[model samples]
Target chain A: MKQRLRPILWLLLREYLEHRRLWALAIGLGLAIIALDLALSLGGQAPAGGLHVMYHSTRALESVSGNRTGTHMIGSLAALGGYDLLLNTIAVLFALTLAVALFSYGLACLYDERRDRSLLFWKSLPISDAQCVAAKAITGLAVLPLVYAVTGLTTVWAAWAINIGLPMTAGPTPPMTAARLVGFSALVLGVLPVYAISLTPGLGWLMLCSAAVRRHPAIIALGMPLLCALLNVFGLPNPIWHWVAAPLVPAGVGHALQSIEAGQAPATALAWVYQPMSQPDPWGGVILGLAFLAAATYCRRRHAVLA
Target chain B: MSESDIVIRARGVSQRFAGRPALTEIDLAVPAHRVVGLIGPNGAGKTTLINRLLGLLVGPGTIRVLGLDPARERHALMQQICFIADVATLPRWLRVAEAIRLMVRLHPGFSAAVCETLLANTDIPRRAHIGQLSKGMVAQLHLVLVLAVDARLLVLDEPTLGLDLLNRRRFYDRLLEHGRSGQRTLLITTHDVAEIEPILTDVIFLDRGRKVLDSSMDALAERFVEVVVPPAVLTEARTLEPCAERCVRDGYALIFDRSRGRDLSAIERLATARNHPTLADLFVAFRTQSNA
Candidate 1:
C-alpha cells in the first residue's frame, strides 16, 4: 500500500504546486477586499448611528444570554456592527471567489493539459490516469477550499483587530482574549470540511465534463443542467438537475448564514452546520461523489488527449 | 531470438476513428536491445502504433510491452517504458528544476544525478520555465529528463522535430551513446530517415495503415538491391521486374526485391554495378510500388 500510495501522493503534490498560484490569487483577492472594506470604513463612509444602535442591542442581548466565552465574542462582534458586516462580507466574498476558482479550475484541469499538448508528457509518466484525475479532483475540492478558508479566517481576525482599535460607542468594551480568537478561528475552520464534503459531487461532475468534452467544457457543464431543466418542463423529473444545482450553493455557507441570521453563537452554528454529516443525505452525496470520481477516472483513461 | 527477447508485441492490432481505420490488422514485434526505426509517410499510422504501444489509446487488439498488457496493465508497463512524443509535449508552466523534482518524486527509475549532469551542459537555467526556453532548449531539456530514466524500452516519435541540424545530430548522438547499451531497446519514428538510417538495426515500413515491410538491416540489405543499369539493357533489367525505376545522370537506377529469387546475375551483366539500397531508397520504392 505504501508503494502504491507514494506515486499518487507525488501526483497530488504536483497538482498543488502547479496550481498554487490560483490559491495565492484567491488569498490576494480576499486581502484586497478586506483592504477596500477598511478604506471605506476609515474614510467616514460607515453609518455610525446605526452601528451604535446595533451595539446597544448586542450588549443587552449579551447581558441576558449569560456571560459565557461565546457570548463575549458575539458581544464584541455586535459592538461594532460595521465590523460585523465587513467580516460577513469578507467571508461571502472569499466563498464566492473560492467557488469561481474551483469552477474554473475543475473545468480546466483536464482540458488545459490537452490544449497545451502537455497531456502527452503527463501520460508518459508511470502514474495511472485514475491517479492523475484524482489528484486534480482533490486539488479543486479539498486543497483550494482549505486555503480559502484559512485566508478568510485570517481576514476575519484582522477585521476584529481593526474594530477593536476604533473608539467605543458608549458601553464598556468586551475584553479581547487569545482564547476568543482561537475559538473564532476554530469556528471558521470547521466549515471547510463540511463545504468540501458537500461540494464533492459538483466538483467531480465538472471534472468529468472537463475530461469528456472536446471543447468548451463550461458550455457543456452549464448546458447539461439547462437541458435537464428543459426535460423537467416536458414533465420528466430531473433529479440530476437538482443534484447538480443544489450543491453549487454550498450547504455549509447556507447553514452558516442561517445560523448567523438566527443570532446563534458561532460554536453552536458550526456544530449545527456539521450535524448533517451524521445523517444519510451527505453520506449519499459522498457515494455519488465517488461514483462521479470513478466516471471521471474512466474518461481520463479512455479519452485520447490530442484526438 | 527467444520470446523473452521481445519487448513489444502487437498481434492483429487495429484502430479506427469515426469508421475510418487509422491502423488495420497490424502485427509487429520489437526485440530487445535493437534500435528499430518506424519509417513511414504522413498518415501512415506510425504515431498510432506508437501510441498503442505506450497505452495512450485503446483500440482493437492485444499489445504487450515488457510482458505486460498495454491497455490493462499500462501502469506496470510504464515502469519499464519511457517515451518522448515530441518536443512540445512538456508542460509550458513547469520550471526546469520543478520538472526535475517532479520526475524524481514520481518516477522511481529517474536519476537526478544523471539529469543534473546532462542539464549542466545546457543553457537552460533552474529557474527558467519551459515556455521561456528556445525550441532546441526545450528538446534538450526533454532529452535530459527522458535519458535520466533507467527504463528498458524508449520510444521516441519525432523527438527531434523542428531542431536544427546540429542539435538533431547531437540529440541522436547522445541517444545512441546512452540508450544503446545492449540492455535497452529503442523504437523511434522520424521523417528524416537518412540521418537515422545509420544507427537503425531494424526498420519497419508502414503505409496506409498497413505494415508493408519489416526486416532487420542485414535482411534488408540481402533482400533488396539497387542496380545502375545502362540504357542499352534497360529492357533486359525491366524483365527482372524492378520495384521502382528512375533516370539518373549515370543511366537508369532500378530497385529490385532480391528476396523473390530474381536473377541478380542478369542485372549484374546488364548493369554497371549493383549495390545495397539505402533505407530511403527502399522506403520510396516500397511506398511507390504499394501506391501503384
Candidate 2:
C-alpha cells in the first residue's frame, strides 16, 4: 500500500504545485474581503442591526437568563439566529473563494495539459491516466479546500479581532473567547466535507468538459448549469437546478433558509441546517461523482495528445 | 538475435487521422544494446510511430516495446521506458526543483544524484520555471529528465528540434555522457540526424508513412555506395542502377544500391573516388528518389 500510495501522493502534490497560485489567490481574496469589511466599518457609522446588536443582545441574554425572564429566552434565540446568519453567510463567501480555486483547477487541469501538449510528459511518468484523474479530483476537491479553509478561518480570526477592537457600543458587547473560536473551527470542519462531497459531481462535470471539449470549455462548463439555474428562475423548479448550485452553497443552509422564510422559527432552523450532515452519508452522490471522473479519465486517454 | 534482445517489435503497424494515413505498414525490430535512429522527413510519421510505441497512441497494428504491450500495459511499460517526446511536452509552469522532487517520488529508479549532477553543469537554477529558461536550457533539462532515470529503453522524438548547433551539440554530448549504460536500448527520431548519426548503430528511414529503409549503420555503409563517375564512365555506372545522381565539379556523384549482389568492381575502377554515403546523404537520396 505504501508503494501504491507514493506515486498517487506525488501526483497530488504535483496538482497542488501546479495550482498553488490559485490557493494564494483564494487566501488573498479572503483577506481582501475582511479588509473591505474593516474599511467600511472603521470610518462609517456602525450598522445597528449587524454585529453590534448581536454582541449586545447576547450580553443582555446572559444577564437576564439569571432571572429566567421571557426576554432572556427571546434574546437568546435572537443571538443564536444572528450567529447562524453571520457565520454561515460569511462561511458561504469564504467557501466561494475556495470553490473558485476548485472550479478553475478542475475546469483547466487536463485542458491546459492537452493545449500545451504537456500531457505527453505527464503520461511519460509511470502513473496511469486514472491515477492522474484521481489525484486531480482528490487535490482540487479535498486537499485544496482544506488549505483554503485554513486561510479562510485565519481571515475570519482577523476579521473577528478587528470587530473586537472596535470602541464599546452603547449596548453591552459579548466577548468571543478562545472557546468560541474553537467552536467556529469545529463548525468549519463539520460543513466542509458536506461542501466537498456535494461539490464533486459538479467538479467532475467540469473536468469532463476539460478533457472532452475542443474549444471554449468554459462555455460548456458553466452553460449547462447556468441553464438549469435559469430554468429554476423561470419557475421550472427542477431539482437538477439545485445540483448546479449544490457545491457552491453548503448543504442544509439553503434548505433552512427556505424553511425559515416560510415562517419556521430561527431557533429551530439549526435542525434544518444540520439535517444534511446528520443523515447517512451521501455515498450515491459520491459514486455519481466517481462515474463522471471515470468518463473524464477515459476522454483524457482517448485524446490526450495529437497522434 | 534472440527475442529477448529485441527492444521494439512492430508488425504491420498502421495509423490514420480523420481517414488520412499517418503511418502505414511499418515493420520494425530494434534489438537491445543498439542506438536506433528513426530518420524521416516532416509529416513522415516519425512522432506518430514513437507515440504508438510509448502507448500515448494506439493504432491499427501490433507494437510491443520491452516485451510489453504499449497500449494496454503502458503503466508497466513506462517503468522501463523513458521518453523525451518534444520541446513543448514539459510543463512550463514546473519549477526545476519541483520537477526533480516529483520525479524522485514517481520513478523509483530516478536518481536525485544524477539529476543534481545534470543540473550542476547547466545554468538552470533550482527555482527557475521551465518557461523562464531559454530553448537550449529546455533541451538540456529534457536530457536531464530522461538520463536520470534507470530505464531499459530511452526514446527521443525531436528532442532538439529548434536549437542552434552549439546547444544541439551540448545536448548530444550530455545525452551520450549519461544516457548509455549497459544493455539499454534507444529509439530516437530527429531531423538533425547528422548530430545523432555517430551514436546511431542502426537507421530506419521513414517516408510518406512507409518504412523505406531499415539497416544497421555497418550494413547501410556496405549497402549504399557513393561514387563519383566521370562522363566517360557514366554509362558504365548505369549498369549498377544507381538510385540517385547529383552533379559535381567534374563528375556525377551517383548513389547505388550495392547490397543487391552486383559487381561494383567495374564502377570502383572507373570512378575517380568511391566512398560510403553519409546518413544525411543517404536520407536525402531516399527521400528525393521516393518523391521522384
Candidate 3:
C-alpha cells in the first residue's frame, strides 16, 4: 500500500506545483478578506463604555458569591465576548472559498486526469479504481480543508494585528483582543470537516463529468451540477419528486448562516432575510463519495485508454 | 516444450462492435520466447485482437493470458503483460521524467534503468512536457515505457507507426536487443511486414477478420512458391495443380502449392524458372485471394 501511494503522491505534488494559480487564488482571497476587515475596523467609531453594566447584568452573582471581583471580571468578560461578527464573516468567506476551491479541484481532477494523462499512469499501475478514487477523495477531504483553514487563520490574524496595532478601537471592542482571536481560530478548525463534507456532492458531479467527457470536459464540468439543480427545482412541486431531491442539498449552508445570525442573540432581521436550511449528517457526504468512486471506476473501465 | 509452454491460448475467440463482427473464431497459440507478427490491411481486426489479448475489451469472447481468463480476471492477467497500441493517446501535460516516474512507481516489474537508457538514446528531454513533443517522439516515449516493463508478454500494435526511418531503425535495434535475451514473448502487428520479417519467427496473415494463413517464416517460404511459367505451360501447370493464376506483363504467374510436394516438374520442363516471392508478396497474394 505504501509502495503504491508513492507514485500517486508524487504525481499530485507535481500537479500542485504546476497549478500554482490555485494556491495564489487562496492567498488572494485571504488578503482580500483581511483588507475588508481592516476597512471595517477603520470605519467604526470608538465604542461606548458599557462593559461595567453588561458584566454586572450577565454575572450579578459573581461579586457576591466569590472573592470580591470587579475590574478583573469586566476585563475577562470583554476578552470573552463581542467577536461573533468577525467569526461569522470569516466562516462564510472560508466556506465559500473552500467550496469554490474544491469544485474547481474536482473538475480539474478528472479534466487534468485526461489532460495530464495521469489517469493512464495511475490505471497502468497495480492500483485499482477504488484506490485511485479514494486517493483523490482523501486529498479532497483532508488536504484541501487544511489549506483553507490555515489560510483563513492567517488572514484573520493579519487583519486582527493590523486593527490593533493601528490602535483603532471600534465601538468599545476588546482593548486587548488576543483571547477572542484564539477562540475564533479554534472554532474555524472545528468546522473544517463540515466544509469538506459540504464539497463532496460537487466532487461526485466532477467525477462523473471526468468519466463522461473526453473532449471539452469543462462543459460537463460546469453544466452537470447546474443541470441537476435545474432538474430538482422543476421537480419541487411534485410531492413524490421533492423527497427524491431533498437529500442532495448539503446542510452546511443553513448551519453557517444560522451560526452567523444566531450569534449571542438571534438577530431576527438578518435571519428572516436569509432563511438558511437545516443541517445534514456527515454520513450523507460519505454516500456521495462512494458515488464518485463508482463513476471513476466506470470511466476507467470503459474509456480510460491513453497513450 | 510442454503444452504449458504456450503463454497465450485462445480458442473460439470472437469479438464484435455495435452488433457487427470484427473477428470470428480466432484460435491462436503463442508459444514462449518468439516474435509473432500479425499482418493485415486496414480494418482487419488486428487492433481488436491485440486489445482482447491485453484484456482491454469485453465482449462474447474467451481470452487467456498466462492461463488466467482475461474476461474474469483482467487486472491479474495484465500484471504479467504490457500493451502499446499505436492510436492510443497518453496525457500530454506530464514531463517525460514525470511520466516515467509514475509508471515505475506503479508497476513493480518496470525497470527504471532501461527506461532511462531508452530515453537517453532519443532527443526526449527529461523535463519536456509530453504535449510539446511530436507524434514520433510520443511513439518513442510510449515504446520506452513498454520496453522498460519486465513482462512475460509484450503486445505492440504498429509500435512504430509514427517514427521516422532513423527512429524506426533504432526501435528495431532495441527490439532485437530485447528479444535476443530469448526470455520474453512479443506479438507485433504492422502493415510493413518486410521491415519486421527478419526478426519475426512466425507470421499470421489476417484478412477481413479471418486467419488466412499462420506459418513459420522458413516453412512458409519453403511451402508456398510463386512460380512463373510461360503462356503455353500455364494451362498445364493449372491442370497439374489447382494453382491460382495472376496475369503478369511478361508471363502467367501461378502460385503453386509446394507444401504437399506437388510436382511442378512438368511445368518447369516447358517454361522459365520460378522466382521465390518475398513474404510481402505472399501476404499480398493471400490477402487479395478473394478479389483475385
Best by TM-score: 1
Docking class of 1: medium
Chain B vs. true chain B: TM-score for each candidate? 0.96, 0.95, 0.88
Quality of model 3 by C-alpha lDDT: 0.67
The TM-score that candidate 2 achieves is 0.86
Two-way DockQ contest, 2 vs 3, winner: 2
lDDT value, residue B178 of candidate 3? 65
Candidate numbers sorted by DockQ from highest down:
2, 1, 3
Which candidate leads the pack in DockQ? Answer: 2
> i-RMS, every candidate?
1.3, 1.1, 3.9
lDDT per residue for candidate 3 within B115-157, as digits (tens), equals: 8877788888889888888877787788788788888888777
Give the total clashing residue pairs for model 1: 0
lDDT of 1 at A271: 77
DockQ winner between 1 and 3, please give it: 1
Which segments of candidate 3 are over 4 A away from where they belong?
Answer: A1-98, A111-123, A155-178, A213-285, A304-307, B179-182, B228-254, B266-276
Residue A34 of model 1 has an lDDT of 58
lDDT of 1 at B141: 88
Error of 3 at A137 (Å): 2.9
Q: List the residue pairs that clash in candidate 1.
A: none
CAPRI class assigned to model 2 = medium
Clash pairs for candidate 2: none
